[model samples]
Target: MMISSWRRRRAARRAGKEPRRNENGEMELTIPRDFRCPISLDLMKDPVTLSTGITYDRESIEKWIEAGNFTCPLTNQVLRSLEPIPNHTIRKRIQDWCVENRSFGIERIPTPRVPVSSTEVLEILSKIDVAFKKEDGEGCRELVVKVKSLAKESERNKRCIVTNGAGSVLSEAFQAFSKASFDVNVAVLEEILSALTIMFPLDGEAKGFLGSVSAMHCLKWFLSSGDLSRRRNAVLVLKELGQEKMDELSEMEGAIEALFKLIKDPICPTATKASLTVIYYMITSTSTNEQLIAEFVNLGIVSLLLETLVDSERGLCEKALGVLDGICNSEEGRQMACNNALSMPVLVKKILRVSNLATELSLSILWKLCKNEKSEDGGVLVEALQVGAFQKLLLLLQLGCVDKTKEKVSELLKLLNLHRNKVECVDPMDFKDLKRSF
Candidate 1:
C-alpha cells in the first residue's frame, strides 16, 4: 500500500499537481478520510449533502447532475430531491483540520461569504430611491454604505446586484444628485461613486446604462479631489464606463487631467493599472486620431509614462510601454518623449527588464521615434545615444529578444553608429566596451 501511494504521488507530481507534504518535508500523499470526495478522489472544497444523506464536493456532484445522474454517488440510491444542501458543518471541519495541519503546507480556507439575496438588494434599492426622492443627503449616504458593503461581500454578490438592476439604480441616483438645483453634498456623491465601484464589474447593459449618466463627469471631481480609496475606485469605474465614451471623457475638462494625475502619481497599484488600461483602450480605439494624440502629448502623458516606468510592476510597465508605443506614432508624442531627459534610459532598461509585452512595446516606441527623423532633435536616435543605449541593445542581441524586436534593435544600432558624430553625449568608453564585447 505504501508503494502504491508513492507511485500515485510520483504520477501526480509528474502530471504537475502539487502533492501534499508532511511536517518532515516528505510527501504525505495519503488522503485524509473525511476530506476526500468519493466521486473525484480529491479534497472537497465545497461539500454538500444529498437527500439520501451522502456527501460529495459541490463541483463534482453538480457535474454528476449535469451529466443526468440522479442517484447518490456513494449509495447509488435514487435521491428523492435534486437540490443538495450545502454541508457547511463538514466544510468548517475541513477548514479547522487545515489550520491544525498548516505546518504540512496546508492553507487555511477562508469562510466563503454568503451571497446577497435578491430580496435584500431590493430593500436597499427601495431605501436608496426613497432617500433620493426626499433629497435626504444623510440618508442617501447611509444607504450607499449598505450597498457598498453588499457589493464588496463577494464576486457573486457583485454580479447578483448588477444583474438585478443595481447598476441602473446606482447610476440614476448619481444623476439625481448632479441635477438637483440645491446644494448637493459632495460626500453623498462620493458615496454614490463608491457604490459604483462595487458594481463596476458590470455587464454590457450596466456599462451602457452607467455611460448614459451625467454623473461620469463627477469622476473628474472625485478622482482629482476625493480620498485615496475613492480615487482608486473612480478610475476603476472609468475603465469600464469610459470605454463607451472615450471621446466624451477626452473632451471633458479636468477628466483628462485626473487620469494623468493617477498615471503620474498613482494612488495605488490598482489605480495605476486602471489608469493604464484606460489609456491603452483610449489610444487603441482612436489610433488614427491625430487630435487625440496631440492631446495626450500636451497632457505630458509620454514623459509622465516614462517616469512611471522606472520601478512599476511588470503589468503596469507593459501597459505604460504599450501606450507609449501607440502615442509615439504621433509627431507631438515622439517629440515629447525624445525631449524627456529620462526617456531613453527608462526605455532601454525596460527592453529586457520587464516582460515580453513590455519589451515589444519599448521596441515599438523606439521604432516610431527612429522612423520620424524630420523633427529638429533627430528623433529617438539622439536620445538613445545620449543614454548609452548601444550597451543594452548589444546585450539584447547577444542574449536574444523576439524576432520583431531584434529587427528594431538592429535598425536602431545602425542609426546609432551613423549618427555617432552628431552624438555629443556619447561616452567614448562605451564604444571601447562595445568593440571589446563584440
Candidate 2:
C-alpha cells in the first residue's frame, strides 16, 4: 500500500501539467501529443518520417502504401519512394517516457527490426532457384523457410516477397517437384507450400502456374493431406483462384467431393469459410448444368448446407445460404430442401437475426420452395407456417426492407396467408351454443 502511494505521488510529479482526478479518484495520465502517430492517433512505437515531413507508425504507412496510394497521407505530396526513414529521436523519447512511467503500466517498446527490401527478397528467390536447379532438397527447404520467416516478419516483407516474384518461383518449384514423381523430399514440398501460403492473393504469374494441371495435382494432394495447415492453405489458394478457373476445379476428379469433405469435417474456421466460398462459386458457375447440380444434390449438399446454417455465424451463414439459393435454382435441389426436416426451421431462425444479406438469402430460398405451391401436399407452405414463418415475415415487413426484398416478402406473405386458415386451429367455446349436461 505504501509503495502504491509512492508511485501515485511520483506519477503526479511527472505530470508536466496538473493531474486531474476522475470519478473513481484515480489520476488520468495524458500522453504527449508528439508521441502519437498522426495517422493512427496512438503512441508511435516505430515512428517513420515521410518525404512530406510527416511522421507515422511504420505499419500504418506501409498499409497505406500497400493500398496503392503513393501520395503522403497527411500532406498529399506525391511520393518518389514508398520507404520511410526511422525517426530515432522520437522513438528514443517515447522509450524513455515509457521507462519513467513503468509504475503506470506503460511498456517500453523494443527497437524495430530493419524493414526487408525487395532487393533482399529477390536475392533469396535467386538462391531458391539455384537450389531447385541442383535438386538440393535440403538447401531448397532452408531457403524457403528463410523466405517464409521474412514474410511473417511484417506486411511490408510480404509485399516485398510477392512483388519480387517469390510466388512464381515457389509455384514453379512445386510443379517441378510434382513432375519429378514426388522425388523431392516431402519436407521440401511442405516448406515450398508454406512459403507460398504467406504470399497470398498470388500474383498473375504465380496464378498461371497454379492453374496448370500439375499445380492442380499438387493442390488435390494437399487437400487430402494429413496436415491440417496444409489443407487450410490448399483451400485458401483455391478460393483465391476465383470463379474464372472454377471450371478447372470442376474438371479435377473428386475435387468437388474433397471440398465437401472439408466442409463436413472442417480443418479450421478460415478453411471452412474458404471451402464454402469455393462451393458457392462452383454452384453459380454451373447454374445451368442440371447434371452437375444433380450431382451436388446426390452428394447431399442441400442437407449439408442446411446443417451448416444451423450453427454458423453471420459470414459463414451468409455464404451457406448463398450456396443453398443457387442449389434451389434446380428442381432436384428444391425437392431435397423441402424434404429435409431442418430446412424451414433453420432458414426461419436466420431471418432478421444475422444480417441483411442472410435474411435476403433465406427469403430467396423460401420463395423458391413456395413458388411452386400447387404440389400434392402443399407441405412446403404448411411447414413454413408451422415453423412460425408467418410471424417472422410480418416482423420483417414492419422493419422495412429494400424494394426487391420487400416484393419477395409481400409475395411470401400472400402465399403463406393462403395457407393460414388451412392450419389446424382450436375450437373456441361459445356459451350460447354450449349444451350443458346436468
Residues 1-438 of candidate 2 have per-residue lDDT tens digits of: 999988886665455223456799997666777888888889898999998888899988888887899999888999977789999999999999888777777899999998888778888889888888788888988989998888888877777888888889998787666666564466787778777877776877778777788777778788877788888888888888788778777767788788888888887888889998998888788534576678889998998888888888888999899989988988899999988999888888788778889989999999999986577557888888877788777777777878999899999999888888877522222112322222
Task: Give per-model TM-scores.
Answer: 0.69, 0.80
RMSD (CA, Å), each prediction: 8.2, 8.2
Error of 2 at 51 (Å): 5.3
lDDT tens digits, residue span 1-438, model 1: 999998987776554244556688777645466778889988788888899988898768867986899898788999898767888998998898777667667787766655577778889898988988788878989998987887776655775677678877777777677666424577787788778876656666656545654666676567676478878877888887755577666667776677778876767888888988887777767534577778778878877887778878888888788888878867788888867878778887676666667767777887677766665655667778777777667777887666777888898888777776777654535334332223
Give the total clashing residue pairs for model 1. Answer: 0
Error of 2 at 274 (Å): 1.1
Worst 10 residues of 1 by lDDT: 429-438
lDDT of 1: 0.75
Candidate 2, pairs of clashing residues: none
